[model samples]
Target: MVREFKLPDVGEGLTEAEIVSWLVEPGDTVAEDQPVAEVETDKAVVEVPAPVNGTVKEILAEEGEMVPVGTVIITFDVEGEVPEPEAEAEPEAEPAEPDGKEAADGEPAEPKDVEATSGRVFAAPSARRLARELGVSIEAVDGSGPGGRVTEADVREAAETSAGEEATEEAAADADSGLKSATRKVTDDADEDEPSTDTDGAEAAGAASETVESADRERTLAAPSTRKLAEEKGVDLDAVPTEQTQDGEPFVTDDQVREYAEAQQQAQAADAEAVSGGAEAPAGGPDIEAGGEDERIPYRGIRKTIGKQMERSKYTAPHVTHHDDVDVTRLVETRGRLKEKAEARDTKLTYMPFVVKAIVAALKEYPVLNSQLDEDNEEIVLKGEYNIGVATATDAGLMVPVIKGADRKGMLDIADEMRDLIEKARDRSIAREEMQGGTFSITNFGAIGGEYATPIINYPETAILGLGAIKDRPRVVEREAQGASDGANGEAVSKEVVPRKVMTLSLSIDHRVIDGAEAAQFVNTVKEYLENPELLLLE
Candidate 1:
């Protein structure tokens, strides 16, 4: 009996998810409750477990394809008697469009006859969609997938070949047109005795058309990472010169893009210098050509989610940032004293743990900083719990894993749990629940070497704190000392400038919820706790 498994709503009410990877193949036997695939939702990457024990039959959805909820993503061959309803429906479903392959008229095609299997072309649903979009006939595309199945790459290659052919025909037509025009010009100018002008015009027309044909003839080949690098550097992979080829096609690499970008910058600088020196510029300006085509990256999953959240936060809230510097000499000393003790207990100590403790302590005193504004009810909802979201930067994007009951956890405990959560977030193995239920957020840009930054408040949370790199700076301090000239019964106070470790903090708050004075006082309280690390012990 064959059992179909539909994708479930993983949580957060996400409408769709992209299949990141498959853990089981078509022939592999899977146990019940075992993870069969990893799917990336808007919140996090989660594993989808098998619903029943069965042999893998077919994968209906391809990796990186965003599938809607309740879509049948896979089918399995289970060892059981088929249910009566399913048994009746199985025959009907088999003849239906299992892969949703459609005709060019935007309608489902008729089911192919089983007897005509010899001429049938096997392709993934996504490949079929691409074929329809590119106006390429799927039957003409050679299969490169397992068991001679036609794949997306095969369809794309077919489309490119067709385009090259069309370009060649167009170029030939252009050459013929130029030849005819040149002939006409020569006949008209026969009495003028200047045939060289017509010849030059013909050659120029041919050169221009040839350049366009060459640009359209072939597409650049590059890995996704190389393409991403090129996009970041604002370099056109098609314009980048490369000596490497893969499968007889031009291949662009990261190093090649970087070198070309450097050369472009140099050329631009030379042009600027020539202009400044009143020198005549080159006829065509800089030699860099525009990109042939734009690269499209699917805007889905975590990246899209982040963009939406940022847009909402920026537009919905009027943000105000308060910046201040705190003397963290005592905080540094305290962490140094506890570092060995923490490592002794198999936990690595970092300044973040102390900062978390301090933030919690401050939030306890100024509850407004740890709250959400209920816009629907027009009320202020101050949260009683301290769930601190530590904003972590991952390769996929920024992820915030919350530390529940942060007020209850000790510094070392926060350190241990934070380390585990960060590791999980970075590897994309974190659960969606682990990233939820936050009362406040913290982003430590200091780790990457920034002094101060105005971080956006994580929506619903009234405020977010940004931490900067700690450095040694001169500060004035007053100390009690004996009289310099004569011995006195009472000690005299003296002021001296000394080097102290300090860190800058930027606190951004929603102005609608938190007043400027309140935000400033809240930061002052946090600074007090950090400046005197012993104060956190009382909390």
Candidate 2:
């Protein structure tokens, strides 16, 4: 039986994806649920997996091609069956090519088939890694698994088979050329559409800094899952060898990747043990190139979404910002005392946990700040539950991961959840639901060295609180003196300046939903709890 595999939704819900790389090609075997290609959506690069076990027969989509949803990208023949295409299998339109541009040497655009997914390589990450560690080329190993998938065992066997093998095909080619080895940059989506190098020195440097256009990527081939796994393990997938290939292109799996990384670490440790030299000089960072005027880069994905949401909020809400200072000396002391206890229970505690507790306490008394505006119905929706959104700045943009029912949780519980959510947001692994259903939001600029900021409301929500860095400043303290010169009865009252910890709080409110006085009172309540953190224990 012949099966046609269409590009399934990779959670973006977008209509199309740019085929980044094909994991398998015609004449190769594949198992059900195995990844066959890597595709780039608007915000992420994801893998397209096979739905059936079969031998690949033909591919409908080309690398660097933008394929629409439900379009058959690849076809396979199962169990000795001849393949046939159905009437609906016809492409609705031609797959869009990356922006047509000339190559570096004044040649026309490079061929789409260059290093294309025109062949098949199937191997686990571990197997590929093992081949690399044993000094074997992944493309040289023959797989034995179904669909010709390479396994760890296959890698071990290949190593044993080539224990004393001669120089590899790659090495032989290098020797035959007898030219100094060199590397060329493989273009990514961010690098594609860039005009070939035409200038020298600084002008050329500016072009490298900003991309003038965008196009498809033709870089290393690996499943999106494998790529993410490699990131989490601090391993470089490109450094791992693979035994599987499509038209001579290597594919990577997870296990071999981790194994290879571990081996490298062990080797580095051994080398360090054998050396008794002084510390090496720190490596210099990448050169910062000056920018060129009139360089315009397309703003899309999360950044575009953020812009739209921000515009809506700013235009729709009547914002009123209130600034105040908080003396959290007691809150700091209490947290420090309990931090060790929290770690013993396998929970990590941060100042945000205490801050959240204080905010929730204040919200219970002033429900208006915890409410949302229902514009269509023109009603104020007072939320009974307290789900607070914590704004975290990531490489992509700002992401708010909400902590659900925060009022019901303890300091430790809130701290742990916040830690996990922040990590997921920064890594772009957070889910849509995790960022929604917030009654109020908080942004801590203090973590990144800011003292205060006027935060814009997260639309529909009533308010947002921005925290500033905590610092020690001189504050007046009252004490009794032995002399009666400035006497209160028989004793003299004296004032002295002492260093005290302080933090600034900037609260932005939707004036339509909350009054200026109400907002001030709510913040005071928060301030009181933090100042007398012992009161928090009673709650």
Candidate 3:
């Protein structure tokens, strides 16, 4: 019995995924729950595990193919059925050949006929596509992949060999034609002017044909976006040098293409300067050639998902940003005091945990900021639980990992769990559930050196707080004089300016649900807790 496995929805309502790679091939035995393939959804990359123990019978989908959910991707022979005997059962060596004339003639068989006589050929889908593009016979190329699977490189090499043979034959045919034309020219004087004209026309036609053939031979391995980049930059993909190779072919990336294009532009600039008597170019000016082309990345995967989410939030909600600076000198001092204690417990503490606690305390006071607007029911749903989402930057894009029951966790616990979630998010190992159920989000652009930014609210959530870089600035402080006294209250006051640590906060809220005054009050509440770090203990 053969069992089929379909692509499942790994993320919430995910309709499709790109097959990144296959870990197992046909005929390979797999265990239950074993990962057979890795797929990239709009959110993250996840492995598809086998449902039961079986030998892989066939892989229906190819790497780089976008497969829809519920589409069968692979088949497994659960009953341990042997398929080798079927090949041996055919009596005639050329089972599919009706005449068997090629065998009788002692000529070698065609590569495609081998598969017809046998069963299916073991080759990657990409290899087959490349073979078709290059006009190479895939069945004729020897595979270099595991289990003797044909790869893209094998097809390219075979195409080169075929092209060389065709070129030789064409040269020979051209030579014979030239010889015949020369002989005819010597025999007939009436058509004397025609020979020179015909020869010139033939030479011109041959040169154009060679140029086309040369362009066709310039092939290199690159992703679709990289290829697009190369085209836009007016740089040939084959001309780009790269240290990476996929399936034994030179693989070009978007960065490599950009570097190559920049080099070309610099070289051209130097050449122009040399020709113009070494005139110095404008300082810090953009090169006209470099500015002509715009870099384009394929809008898909995590980046695309983020774009859609942002668009929805911006268009659906009227966002209002309230910016203010907080005196976190005490908060900084408190974290410094607790830093060593956290490290003693094998934990690295950061200011995020303190900020999270402050935000939770403020949210408790202003429940409206922690609620969602349900337009369908014309009601504002106020959330009772505190699920704080920490917006983390990753190689794929921005990912927010939510901390559940944040109000109940201690500062150290929040630090530990937040660190764990951030690490997992950066490495893309976090599950979907870990990123969901957030009532509010915090984006710390401060970690990257930004002063302040109006962070868009994570959709379905009412508000998001943006933290800016902490810096020491001069602030006013009032103090009572040591010995001087006035008749009233018997005290003398003095004002002084001193340097204090300050952090800018930008709080963006859905204007429909939270009023501007309420938004300002919420930040003020957060500031009060942060200014006196000990007050967070009462939360």
Writing each residue's lDDT as its tens digit, candidate 3 over 1-539 gives: 67878899998899778788999988799999999999988877888999988898767666775666886778788855654542343222222234544544354344442332234456655567666666555556786666677665466556555554554466456544434332332243546454442343343333323322212224466654456667788777777766656545566666666656655554443334334433345579786664554655546778889999999999999999999999989889999999999999988999999999999999998999999998999999999899999999999999999999999999889999999998988877788889999999999999878987989999899999999999999999878887666567877876789999999999999999999999999999999999998998788
List TM-scores for all candidates, in order: 0.68, 0.57, 0.68
Candidate 3, TM-score vs. the true structure?
0.68
The deviation in Å at residue 225 for candidate 1 is: 17
Clashing pairs in 3: none
Off by over 4 Å in 1: 80-141, 150-297, 484-491
The per-residue C-alpha lDDT of model 2 at residue 122 equals: 59
Better of 2 and 3 by TM-score: 3
How many residue pairs of model 2 clash at the backbone? 13
Instruction: Kindly report which residue stretches of model 3 are placed more than 4 angstroms away from their true locations once superposed.
Output: 25-28, 56-63, 75-86, 89-295, 483-490
**Residues 1-539, model 1: lDDT tens digits:** 77889999997687667789999887688999999999998877899999988887667666755566787778788856443332233211122255888656464554453121236576655567767776666766787555677665566666556655554466456544434433433243445544343334434444433332112323576644566777777776778766556446786656566656654544444344333443344578878868876666656588988998888998998999999999999999989999999999999999998889888988887899999999999999999999999999998899999999998998889999999999999999998889888999999999888998889889989999999999999999878776642245455777789999999999999999999999889889889999988988887
Candidate 1 least-lDDT 10 residues: 86-95
The alpha-carbon root-mean-square deviation between model 1 and the true structure, to one decimal in Å, is 10.9
Which 10-residue window of candidate 2 scores lowest in summed lDDT?
178-187
TM-score: model 1 vs. ground truth: 0.68
Residue pairs whose backbone atoms clash in candidate 1:
none
